[model samples]
Target chain A: MTSPRRVTPEPFVWLMFSAGGVVAALILPVLLVLFGVAIPLGWVEAPDHAHLLAVLRHPLTRLALFGVCALALVHAAHRLRFTVEHTFRLGRYDPAIATVTYGAAAAGAAAAAYLLLTAFG
Target chain B: MISPLEARYYRRRMPLLWWAHRRSYAIFVLRELSSAFVALFIVELLLLVRATARGPAAYESFLDTMAHPAMIVLNLIALAFVLLHAITFANLTPRAMIVRLRGRRVPSRVVLAGVYAGWLLVTAFLAWLLVAA
Candidate 1:
């Protein structure tokens, strides 16, 4: 006889964590070096104010950035959740820990969406 | 009375600084901590977008704030952590994924090389878009 199917949120959470990890690894470094270090240090010419604003106005740019921010946040949440659990031996408080970590990620993602889609426009 | 199995077993209490006891453990902890840096970078990006949305003057001020010595130093540290995150994550990708090409399985080394190559290509394109374009 076939076993009954079980549904759980664990796999979907893991999928988000994995996708976020890949996106953060591939895209974040260059963006960080340019905006965080090079331009601010005056090693590279900063993109002009009008040019930056124009770029931000583009729907595609906003959408791509939103994807990056939201995914990265979720990735961070997943890792932080486990790290806190193991490092502190807080396994008994798993439910509370998961709620806090994932809640923050969701809130951050919502903020990113609001900023990108509505506030910017 | 305790069961014979329970009485026979010994459970060692884990120390609070278990991760600090070994070099590899320390590195593993640092790798885990890198996620916080990733989150910090995203928060910075969101603030940047918000500043831009506010207007040119606010954007310029945001840039000034970012250029502050303290902010610059913080970003530098964050950069180091984020790079660690990227490199560690990329290296682990091969073990997590098994790719097959036709009838042959792709070697882990080949998969790793492909990942690094993609990283470089993406970085180059973004650099051109942001700096050269």
Candidate 2:
């Protein structure tokens, strides 16, 4: 018989989290306009389709869109956190850096998302 | 009398997630929270404009008090943060788009440059049309 092995169940918490994050990123901007900005600006007097499209199409949209997608990327890597944690037992150096990268990348995405959505949307 | 029906299945969210997982979620939220300022600036300015339209004194106060040096400086700083919030996000959009070309991954910087270039060209053309007319 082969040597007995120790095994730990990989937790899937981050996997679920990133998935939710991706969904939230897309819906948040549209909701923000409808619920937050639009009412204050007076929905009835809001500009017609052409202006709306222009504003939404502005350079900012690309920027804010980064938010929605960034969450997805981090979410992807985060899903493997447990696997990575167990695979080689990496800590302090690469793991710390990975965490930072995830945070920074997400933030960068968010900034782009907000810029694009608000400026263009 | 009508009886209240049993609720359908409800999803459960954890009170607090484990550290690694929580950190990512927090970052997601914090970044979203920071960008709120851009909307605040735009909406506040719109409100100020609307208020100014009401009377001379209102407009004067908007120009004088609200536009005071300290507030202007604050706004300038806010503007920088807002721009930071914007550009960072703009550069990230391509990744989300999932578009690919020529069997190689396209660079986000290229996407950003193309977007910026298009805007500048459009703005220039519009100015020309307006000026000529």
Candidate 3:
């Protein structure tokens, strides 16, 4: 008797993407507005270097930043993977495309974790 | 029976600039491109963390680099794109999530409001933390 093929573990990947999307939506705009526009345009005084450094030095802040960075990378990887595949009609190379995108995200998250840990530890 | 000639249909190839032809498509493409900016910001933060690891002088130097005019312009552009990304993503949340209460489907506007409310609370908390510090 022929056996049915196992379903791929795609939902977990999608869950990561969804979580990242929520996190990015909640936080990124605020960060960008503050650091990118308000400070640069003089609408608000930029946080002094010492103060900003102190915040980053905080353990909780480091963890939060690391979480955002890692998850956002996964989110971007998933989006870019689909965007490239659809735009270029590369559906035939799905496995290679997924590997490259997710691999890059994993590497980025690893780098972020290493930097966050060593920099503050 | 249908003739082969009658069954055949022409397929118009999607143009390179197809996204440009419609405002919605352009916005979508820009939204996807915004992820690159998000990645850049992550790299920038990593560098910041690295600088902090090196101590005050390195961190100050990093701030100096960030204060440069070119970096400011790039950051402003990034801010615009990222804001667009966030808004579009937030608007899509209601569709992606199906909330239910007491066996009835929750309204989409309610879901959207909840998402934005959460965003507002988080932003307020961050702002308060920054100001208080």
Candidate 4:
């Protein structure tokens, strides 16, 4: 048989997963705390709408936001794919699962980038 | 009189709800579920960016919508899940990246502490910048 398909995409995927894991773990909670909890709960003074938008308008801020969104998406996708595969015992559907999960994440990242670029432009 | 029963071979797959049986398994599932919430927040962020682009009125309206009681409740739940993800990820990092100090392996607790410390520093800096600007 075709040498049993020597090359696997898993390593590259795992690298993204690992990197995304770090980004998500380090950055996501603080972001959620600030935006989701603190501001909503009135723990911190909420930044006015215009002020926040001005920050988003910055190129560097946009880049960072895009990076965070992309990595967090990838992290979610990889974790979700593996969890579903294992939990459901979908051994035979590995390729399909990988494609759907990672593909969605890639599409999301592209969408985020497009939105950020066009919005600022 | 009852007839003797015949023995039958059965393929027993693990239960679909197997994760519920053990605390560790349940925690694992929760951690995985938290990632979905994280992704949800990112999507929300993207929407916020789009709203901002539309105009100040649109952005202000978006904020008002987000500040609604229902949205606040949803966001609070999302925050809980994100915190779960972050804590579990932090606890697991030392296992993933085994650092060495000279020839000795660094302690796992130290690695975890470093992760938290870094998170604190970044959050502080962001808060400072936001307040200063």
Candidate 3: tens digits of C-alpha lDDT, residues A40-111: 566777666667767888889989988998899999888888887776667679899999988988999999
Chain A only: list TM-scores of all candidates.
0.93, 0.35, 0.89, 0.88
TM-score of 3: 0.86
Count of residue pairs whose backbone atoms collide, per candidate:
0, 20, 0, 0
Residues B5-101, candidate 3, lDDT per residue (tens digit)?
A: 8568644577767778898987788888888787777777688778877887887787678778998899888888777778988999889989999
DockQ for each candidate?
Answer: 0.82, 0.03, 0.55, 0.59
Candidate 1 residue lDDT tens string, B8-51: 89567899889999999999999999999999999998998998
TM-score of chain B of each: 0.91, 0.53, 0.86, 0.84
TM-score of 4: 0.88
Sorted by DockQ (best first), the order is: 1, 4, 3, 2
lDDT of 2 by residue, A1-121 (tens): 9878856322443554444343333333333332233333344232333433443354553444354445544543453343344333444365574676456546645554554445432
Query: Candidate 2 at residue B21, lDDT?
Result: 60
Error of 2 at A26 (Å): 18
By TM-score, the best candidate is 1
RMSD of every prediction: 1.9, 17.4, 3.2, 4.6
Question: Ranking under TM-score, best-scoring first?
Answer: 1, 4, 3, 2
Determine which window of 10 residues in candidate 3 chain A has minimal summed lDDT: A33-42
Model 2 regions more than 4 Å off? A1-121, B1-30, B55-57, B98-107, B118-133
Q: Candidate 2: how close is chain B to the reference, as a TM-score?
A: 0.53
* lDDT score, candidate 1, position B44: 91
